[model samples]
Target: MQRKVLVIEDSAVSMNLVTRLVQQAKLMPICAATLTEAKHLFSQSNPEEFLCAVVDYHLPDAPHGEAIDYAIASFVPTIVITGRLDEETRTHVLSKEVVDYIPKENTQVYDYLSRLLARMEKNKHIGVLVVDHMRSSRTSMASLLRRHNFETFEASSAQEGLDILHQRDNVQLIVTDFKVPDMNGTQFVAELRKSWPKEQLAIIGVSSGNSALLSARFIKSGANDFLQKPYCHEEFLVRIMQNVEYIENVETIRRAANSDYLTGLPNRRHFFYSVNHVARTSPALQSVALIDLDHFKRVNDQFGHDAGDKVLKEVAKLIANHFSDHNVSRFGGEEFCLYFANVAAEEVDKSLESFRRAVRERPIRHQQQDIPISASIGVTHQGRKNLDAMLAKADELLYRAKSSGRNQLQSDLLA
Candidate 1:
């Protein structure tokens, strides 16, 4: 499910700022100006309504702990923001279920909220322990991760690294270099892998000079990957991301399993996912356009399936070109669908007309003849209806377009 964020602030400016920040964090946001309104919104929503919430300590309706308590009860990770976070209130605030207490106008508020969002994503705290016996190396690595917004811990030796790993379950990745005195890198990673096994923590080994044999040994010892030392800034960042991004990509592709293979366009599964995601995330009005190629069966009949595939590829490219800014997907077979964010149905008509003109001007070149094609697009705007219902309406209009005239665009907007 997509993570939703609730920003409960009475000040419109502060509310707007927090909303933008939450959106930038890639979470859905629902704004509530008062505690009563927030409660009203919360009661009618599902249990997964939100992942986290940003709530001001003082609200227009309820200034005390009621709103925050309500949020906590609803299982949303809460961040309490106020201008009155002195030592006394800070202690009391931390005692509550709130994630962090922040001073609203402070420039560091961004950092505070960003870190809170990261921690909430983990469903817990963020901690990275650097394992190097050398005082300078330990300090440098830990300081770097900390500067990049990670909470870091340092372990001075292999034994110390083991101790920190035992306690810090949230340690996502470790950057440890070879050449630690006493027990070297090989022994350290070997012991780490042995203990953790499948849920073993991520490891990135570091070595300087020609450590090809050393890298092989480390990989055998269960390190996920390694980077040679004396690496520049870009190399360091890229290596870090290479090791980290795989986890995210796996999760995204797992979610995107329904995507089609032929044209790399989203299939029915991705279409619904995007539709639901866009519905939850976009605040502006929107419309959907269902597109189908005119006389699609004749193309398939005259030119074998190979030629049909080429036409589909070309159509996919055209759809991508015209609907680049929208949520365009292949709804199986020859049908293409788009959810134009913040665009009205009337606007979709103009957009579809331009698309038709472009595709007709370009030829598919089947059988050495300039085989021209046109599309009939049907558009319908958002309504108090589900995606299924809206699709039915769009499908009806698409039939109208096909029957009335093969090359014309028809819309179900208003009358």
Candidate 2:
């Protein structure tokens, strides 16, 4: 249990005793008596050097909450320990949302701290799912995953994995055997790619027999990684964590490029890219719409920018609430867009009618006053060849909606 812990205690004598306790638990303890000392210590050490922190409230420099905030900001789980404080103060300090709180004067502080640190050590691990055709292989792989503190599950077949996904939700990863009954792992993953979130799952397809082109096929069918069976435990753990981290990194990158931080909606770039992809890939009918709030500038001028932001968010909620099935995006300030793939042109009218009714029925009240907001939509279906052409046509129809009437939908609406 060679874990690292930062112990912040004001009393040097108490610090010495706690240090010994941490050492006895087989942990590396870093001691700091004050907020300044803890800050300096953290700023100087490598991130990988420390696992978590045990902070003290009422440090000499700053009292309560500050240390907790700083430690949490540094991505360390913090436990606040204090003595010579009343119950109110202890409750107040604990209320600061630190991971845990304790009294140093209590007889059980050392035992409690030991248990907390051990729990943290065990929790910072990857989760794995082992899918194998044979029971012996499944158990073997699950044991290998568990040795590294991973919470692992097992499935005997690919179809069983589909059932397992329904039963288990926290599973962030899958390590499936290449060959299985009913559906092979590759085919099963291909089906999974349609519904499940590809970015959230770190899939490792395993193969024991004929490790030839199967690995490449797995990667092609949406598996993020591969592992040859009879793998060494260390190699397996490393590879599994690597893929987990890789998926998280890719998601971070995609979010940076595609998401709006303000309303937490897809940005214009993401909207455009998705529209194009669906247009090129799906031969099924689809519709694209450019939606704009009417008299949005007036709302901003009347309500101040903050209130205007609230209204935009409110409208976004309306769009999401009313058209939950459609892919929606915020196209900059007061402007938005939507894509309904695989819907007929005539059906688009009925859907948009329902969306319009929903928005009109709901009122956005701010400061006890109802602020009316309505959108003009320019919608068009792809009879056209490419996505760009559909967008151009939708924009034209959108212009017609805005020019003709503010609260209306137009087809071939663009000027």
Q: TM-score: which candidate is best?
A: 2
* Per-residue lDDT of model 1, residues 300-325, tens digit only: 88787777778888889888887888
For candidate 2, write residues 169-217 as lDDT tens digits: 7677888887878788899788778767668777888888675999999
Q: Highest lDDT, which number?
A: 2
List residue ranges in candidate 1 displaced over 4 A. 1-258
Q: Model 1 Cα displacement at 314 (Å)?
A: 0.7
**How many clashes does each candidate structure show, in the order listed?**
1, 4
TM-score of each: 0.45, 0.52
lDDT of 2: 0.76
Q: Point out where model 2 deviates above 4 Å.
A: 1-127, 131-151, 155-171, 174-246, 282-284, 413-415
Compute the lDDT of residue 226 as modeled in candidate 1.
Answer: 81
